[model samples]
Target: MLEFKTTSPEETFAFGQCLAKVLSAGQVVCLVGDLGAGKTLLVQGMAAGLDIQDAINSPTFTILNVYEASFPVYHFDLYRLEDAAELYDIGFYEYTEGDGLSIIEWPDKFPDQLPDEYLWIEINSDFVNNGGKVNERVIRISALGTAYEHICEELKQICPFLP
Candidate 1:
């Protein structure tokens, strides 16, 4: 696992921008975080890196949102899902196996349904200890595939804050 500490929301987003530099088609990124833990912030930065023009927002109510970029970004928010089977209703499997990049939020809701190999990111905050600064976050990135393993190494080089 690779770990990073972001003192502000911008830093967290910057991390995502950096991460996007290493991403490619048919890749899946699973974001696990608490409410307001900067998961969407990171994705927005990724949107910027991918040159997505539209505003990036959490797909909480919509289940999924697709954005234009070098390759399509299939963003999904599974927080509202009642069960893993509901994934089919939103074409989750198709997107995951398709030729686009997939970004999933609240993946813990259906851990078993996720592909065997994907990027898993965990973001946690220390608001209580940081005087309630909502932006303080520690992000952990892990690779479950051979390609992602190499990508993580590349990320460590470009991301100065990764430790």
Candidate 2:
């Protein structure tokens, strides 16, 4: 596991962009965060690093969004899903096994449906007890597969704040 801190949304996105530099086909990144915790921002940065020309946005309603880039990026937002069955109904398995970089948000909704070859990225916010409205964002990364472990090490070198 690796932990890093981001002071702002842009930093979060920058982190994503940095991670994107090392991404390739057959990569699955599971993003676990609060609603406004900058998960999408990180993905947008990843897209930028991947040379995705078009804008990248959250696919909460659409469930999935695909972008053309140096390598394909398949973004999925499963926030609305109630069960793994719903995900299966939408061909979630196919997406995970496809030849592209898969980035998923709200993966907890379909835990059983997720492949064992994914990297879990968890983001949490911490409040400063002695400060006046200041917060620290913690980003934790856990890689399950050998490929992901190597990719994550590469990503850490790119992200200066990685711990």
Candidate 3:
């Protein structure tokens, strides 16, 4: 497990970009966080690292957004999903198992549907709330398989400033 703290959205996105640089096809990353935990910002950094020049936004309404970069990237938002069954119905398995990188938001809503071998990331806001302004955040990353461990190590190297 890797733990880190960020004080701003830019730092959070930079951390995500570091990880994104190491991502490739057939990789699934589940992001667990609350409503304003910077999940989308992290995804933005990941997309930037992947060399995706297009805009990266939360696919809350569309459910999934596909982008082409160094490799295919499939971004999914499960916040609107009623259950894991809806994920299957939307052909989420195709993305998770296909030749593309899959990044999912609100994965807690579909724990059983999540891939067992996928990487997990949890983001939480620390005590710094004044009218909904977060001053600190905690991000926990866990590697669930050998492939994910390799990716984590690669991400570690992607940013020399990262600890």
Candidate 4:
């Protein structure tokens, strides 16, 4: 596992941009975080890193958004999904199993249905004594298979402070 800390949204986004530098086609990245945990912000930085000019928004209502980049980026938000079957209805497998890169938010909704090999990221925020947001986050990244393990190794090089 690899871990890093960010004190601001910009730092979180910068981490995502650094992460994107090591990603490639056919990769699936799973993001687990609470609401307002900066998942979308990180993805926005990834889009920028991929040279995508379109506005990157949370696909809460749309469920899926396809962006044109050097290859393709399939972004999915599963927050509203009540059943794993809904994934099939949205052609989730087709997009995820295709040649493009896949980034999924709220994948914990159907954890058992995820691909066998993928990148898993969990973002947790720090709160003040009064439970107010502090704009601080600890991002934990891990790999599920050999390919993803290599990716994690590459990430360590990109973010030397990761430990």
**CA lDDT, candidate 1, residue 61:** 97
Model 1 spans > 4 angstroms off? 128-131
Off by over 4 Å in 4: 128-133, 160-163
Please state the error at residue 119 of candidate 1 in Å: 0.4
lDDT of each: 0.92, 0.85, 0.86, 0.91
State the lDDT of candidate 2 residue by residue for 114-151, as single tens digits: 89888999988765676533266789999998998998
Candidate 1: the clashing residue pairs are none
Local lDDT at 12 for model 4: 83
Measured over all alpha carbons after superposition, the RMSD of each candidate to the real structure, in angstroms, is: 1.4, 2.4, 1.7, 1.7
TM for every model, in the order presented, reads 0.95, 0.91, 0.92, 0.94
Expressed as tens digits, the lDDT of each residue in 10-35 for candidate 3 is 88888888888778899999999989
lDDT (Cα) of model 3:
0.86
Q: Residues 1-163, candidate 4: write the lDDT tens digits.
A: 8899988778888888988999999999999999988899889989988989999999999999999999999999999999999999999999889999999999999999899899999998887666575568889999999999999998888874353
Ranking by TM-score: 1, 4, 3, 2
lDDT of 1 by residue, 25-46 (tens): 9999999999989999999999
Worst ten in a row by lDDT for model 1:
127-136
The residue-level lDDT of candidate 1 at 24 comes to 91
